[model samples]
Target chain A: MLAALAFVAGWPLARTIWFGFTDASLGSLADAEWVGFANYLEWFDYGDGEGEWFGLLADAAWWEAVRNTLFFALVTVSIETALGMVVALVLNARFPLRGLVRAGVLVPWAIPTIVSAKMWAWMLNDQFGIINDLGVRLGLLAAPVAWVASADTALIAVMIVDIWKTTPFMALLILAGLQMIPEDIYEAARIDGVNPLLVFWKVTLPLVAPAILVAIVFRALDALRVFDIVYVLTPNNASTTTMSVFAQQNLFQFDQFAYGSAASTALFLVIGLVTLGYLRLARLDLGN
Target chain B: MRRAVGLAKRIGFWALVALILFVSLFPFYYAILTSLETGTAIFEPNYFPEVFDLRNYAQVLGQGSFPRNVLNSILVATATVAISLFLGVTAAFALARIPFRGRKLLLLTVLSVSMFPQIAVLAGLFEMMRFLGLYNTLGSLILSYLIFTLPFTVWVLTTFMRDLPIEIEEAAIVDGAGPWDIVRRVFLPLMGPALAATGLLAFIQAWNEFLFALTFVASNETRTVPVAIALISGASSQETPWGPIMAASVIVTAPLIVLVMIFQRRIAAGLTTGGVKG
Candidate 1:
């Protein structure tokens, strides 16, 4: 199985890294020539202060994508974590039909990302969408707003969809952490007549910190590499393009294989470094 | 005042839960609602299911290549789950029980492989598929899906297997059982729930996968449900067939919802274990 993984994943990764440094394109791999750091250089090049910056680093579109991804990750993960904690806390409380409610929460998470994207795309449609109608009825919008079509709101629309689909995943993970907390801790705090807010701050937060950290890190990585939601919801929308989308567009749509590989490699490195940073901060040991 | 505060708090809690449930399910509920509306009925923003129409579902199923796409999705997902489980179980045993050298490194390597963005492998895998004459075939999808499926299956299954009692295996070995015998007779039965959980998760992953399914396959006949639904066009270029798209989305999503409902506990166990351990 390790050998299989190596052949399927490792070999391809190695090839991508190699191809990133070459002049490879579709259907011409055999005749592709080696170029040392040319692709990397081209990605970093800043044109003489005249024409639009062509290099990916200086390119406005790429920077917008990077900013969008970062903003998306920051906003969504934070909100999801907060909302997940609240939902987990509520579920942890003694309530009737809790199991049914818990199962209900997983519905969104179970729905395929693409399906949800399409669902939201339609729901956010400016014309004949229930959301717009509701907004109009409730006086939320002066008129029906094109949620996903305009550049100003496209990223926000995508973020809303992502948060909707993934907050359940976050809630469940945090709920698992919540379940691990012994009742005695809270019982003792209650006996001491500690305020609930104080108890949560002093006990619950510290105990669930590791789980929340893990959840946040994982979700952040996922958001950083987001493709399906953005691609399906806002295809080729420069404001909403992520690293994965950009790389895929270059490789498949535009057929700039080498340049695409370079972009992909850059994404890989970014994710790897962030993961390493997280591991170090969390002090997580995988050997066990 | 205290009783008032308590009542307010109680109301607040239920209201929050209701909001969560509504937000979680409203899209799918609306999708169903929209799917049941035919013609210009969809154009009217009616929240309630006023009319029941099966035409959209029939349109999606009876129309060109949608049924084939659904079949292809089922075929690829099932094959992926079967192969991933078979390999994952055996690999988990080796990694968990066999006491091999570099086991830790191998496990870490497996974990890392899953983290490599799929696009990083797109160029390479595309070349490889073409080389092996597997490009645009279900075989390409099965193989590529393994890139994501195998790693998590092996990781989670290994964690589960390591928790099983060693005495059971020892007792089997005392009865003159070989490794394969131990696996088939002793371990397989015990692993039913774990296998089901991991297999279901793998199936979902394969079903939901889009990047590879979009990039690797070309023909409409070969496309998976996601690509099919994504490419589902309207009567003309100017308009999108939202009705058919929602119908197809519901068709493809129904099985997943059923599976998740049936196996919610096990799925939760698998996810938490995988996340905490990894």
Candidate 2:
């Protein structure tokens, strides 16, 4: 089992990192020559030792992708966490048909990412989009606005799709934490005549805080590597181009395999650092 | 006055529940509604199913390798789930039940691998596929899909395995059973629910995987449903066949919805066990 994981994940990752150093193209991997730091950054010397930097690190598009990925991660994770908390709280409350409601919530989570992306893409179509039709009719918009196709609304569209699909996951995790809390804590608060709102703020939130923290890290990392939604919803739209999309596009489409590997390696470094920093700050000893 | 306030509170609670259900489920409802509408009627965004015409469904299902795509998805997902569970259960026994040097580190390593971005390995996996002559074959996807699915299955099953009462295993040992026999004959049966949940989740993950499917497989015949739906583009972006696309989306999501409905409890449990419990 470890062997499979090593081959599938570890070996490929090692090869990817190595490819980052060598100037390899897609078709002719065997013929590629080693050029350390050239893919990441290199000071190209000119006449009289005047030089300019060039590499994946120096590329404006790569940085734009980084910014877009971070922004998407930040916005979507924050919204999903907050919204998921609300949903989890609701689920935890005494409600009729709770099972049905819970299953209903899982619908979005259960749907395939690509299918949901395509589903939203169809609904966000400016010409025949339900969103545009409803927006115009309900005074949400005066015109039929192109959603995923338009530059201005494209990133927002991607975030909206992501948050919609992922909030259920966050909610489910938080709900599990909520269930883990002993019911008597709330009972005591009620006996003391504590305000329900205060019980939620001072009691419930603090107890479920760890689960929320873990869920945040999980969702945030996943969001940072967002690909399918952006790729399907707003393909080739520069405004919504994320690191994964940008890297994959270069890897195969543009045939800049080595450069794409650098971008990918950069992304891995960011995620790795974030994971370590989070593990450190949270003191989450998974070994336990 | 107090009675009126109580009434308002009750109304508000129900309203909130209704809203949650709506936001959670409205898009799928809209997708089904859209799928039912035919040609030009699709342009009109009626909230309800305006027509029950199956033409769009027929159109997508009848031609253009969409059904073949669905079959490909089923075949790949089933194999992935089967192999992952088979491998995962054994790994879990070793990781959870046995103590060994570097075991903790190896377990953590498996956990971290699940966090890997698919793009990070795409270039290399693509090359690996070509070198092994598995490129464009379904085998390439199954192998790449394992990178994500295997970790989750192992982690979740390990958690489940540790929680199993040791008395049963002790009794099995007294019956002169070896470790392999204990795992295959003893714990395997006991892990039925956990295995089902983990396998379902793994199946869904494999079914829905797009990045690897798109990167590894190159032919129309080998395309899974996700990639098929994604590649189901029109001549102009504006002229996209929404009817067929929505139809295909619904088709691809239907079995998953059914599976989730049947196993929602187990899946929810599996998801948290694999995630928050860590």
Top of the candidates by TM-score? 2
Please state the CAPRI-style docking class of candidate 1.
medium
lDDT score for residue B100 of model 2? 90
**Regions of candidate 1 where Cα sits further than 4 Å from its true position:** A42-55, A284-288, B1-3, B276-278
Residues A195-259, candidate 2, lDDT per residue (tens digit)?
A: 98999899999899899998998898899889999989888889999999999998989999999
lDDT of 2 by residue, B79-174 (tens): 999889999998999999888999888888898898998899888898899999999999998889888889989999999999999999999999
Q: Runs in model 2 with CA error above 4 Å?
A: A48-50, A284-288, B235-238, B276-278
- The residue pairs found clashing in candidate 1 are none
Q: What TM-score goes with each of the models?
A: 0.95, 0.97
Q: Ten residues in a row with the worst lDDT in model 2 chain A?
A: A279-288
Give the lDDT of residue B1 in candidate 2. Answer: 100
For each candidate, the DockQ is 0.65, 0.68
DockQ of 2: 0.68
